[model samples]
Target: MTALPETTAKKLGLVIDLDTCVGCHACVVACKGWNTENYGAPLSDQSAYGAAPKGTFLNRVHAYEVQPDTGAAQTVHFPKSCLHCEDAPCVTVCPTGASYKRVEDGIVLVNEDDCIGCGLCAWACPYGARELDKAAGVMKKCTLCVDRIYNENLPEEDREPACVRTCPAGARHFGDLGDPGSAVSQLVIEREGVDLMPELGTKPVNKYLPPRPKDVLDEIDVLSPFLAPVAEESKGLAGWLDRVLEKI
Candidate 1:
């Protein structure tokens, strides 16, 4: 394992908004498509033609049912990927020195040539960001779309990661977290963004914007009070609904 640089020049990372992510897997698809093609390794799937299939992906979205103390149940769509931590456990555990964090930009990367499929990095990672491409016999992870972000051949607007570019809800964002004036950093400050598993001490660079609390509206009457009297006059539920519609 190679020692991390004393200080990284730039902490380039992502800020994901849980409130806006719709669990549509748009980011997942776009991530897989871009990384598999742009990155050196080809992310392979096992038994893809069969009923049960699994594939290596750099990014994935998960949905969870969250119920607060006093409100309706809500679904939180969470997008997970490599955080490019300052003291990345995954990079430190690589015996072959294949896993390393870039001192210039803070992007954690795996050198496929040096990887021996030991799976230590994957196990060391608390965020499950490192994945083994069983078919390719090496570890894989998100590189923060390093290729596209630095490619001068592409249009300025298309320079961002595919996941950020393809998100229909605009839930994903990419920028330098090291610079306080950066847009992603301002978002973290404004939204009170948090790190995932901060206790583990990996010092993940990526941040997540927590879901904004929703205001309860059940107790508030949205319709006119005259509709209430009309509801009492109705004979059944359908009749009450009809009366409410008529009142509207």
Candidate 2:
């Protein structure tokens, strides 16, 4: 009997197309639903039926208004979570072995069993990726759906992170970033995607492509007839005489 080839180690990562994302929050909801069922502890909500309700989520979408004086206000909706950085500060800061980067796939994961909830890893991260899971008393963040992507029972097409699968606007893409031929790598090259807070030098594996600039309304207004002088007023002998004298 022939044995199957061993699965090669891959640097799995995500490339988010900010230009294409519609801020639908489908990816956030999908992540919550999947992680709740698969992970060690569910993301629970406190005071669900009362006021001051809150819950823990591995991923969250944030909306920001970016205004330029020369253009219209741009509404940018970006998802925030663990970047699974190449030089992950979270891993180095952990006194316990709880926070770690997977050598096989480059996913930053917290071993819940070993976590003491020191919150050091949270502070080490510049992107605000890590969050304390109050119910579990451990730090939690995006896992890239590690359990689902490698499942043998799942079809090849279905083997992807929940966020990528559920993104309604096709904003999310998942693949081996280390491979130059990979789709995610190609996208990063084509879009000139930027890392958030690059000055921190976490060397984040995740990439965010900036939104394309929209047309300015003020430019259109400048060409309207209401703003321009009437052609007839500048014509005839008076206009000709004025034009001739002005040339001097």
Task: List where candidate 1 sits over 4 angstroms from the true fold.
Answer: 218-248
Let me know the TM-score candidate 1 reaches against the reference structure. Answer: 0.88
What's model 2's lDDT at 197? 91
lDDT of 1 at 197: 91
How many clashes (backbone N, Cα, C below 3 Å) per candidate? 0, 0
Clashes of 1: 0
What is the TM-score (0 to 1) of candidate 2?
A: 0.82
Per-candidate Cα lDDT values, in order, are 0.90, 0.83
Q: Judged by TM-score, which candidate is best?
A: 1
Q: Per-residue lDDT of 25-128 in model 2, one digit per residue for the tens?
A: 99989998998889667777778778788888878889999988865789988987788888787888788788878778888888888889999989988888
Candidate 1 clashing pairs, residues 3+ apart or interchain = none
For model 1, residues 47-159, the per-residue Cα lDDT tens digits are 98999999999898988989878669888999999999999988877888999989899899998999989998899999888889978899999988899999999999999
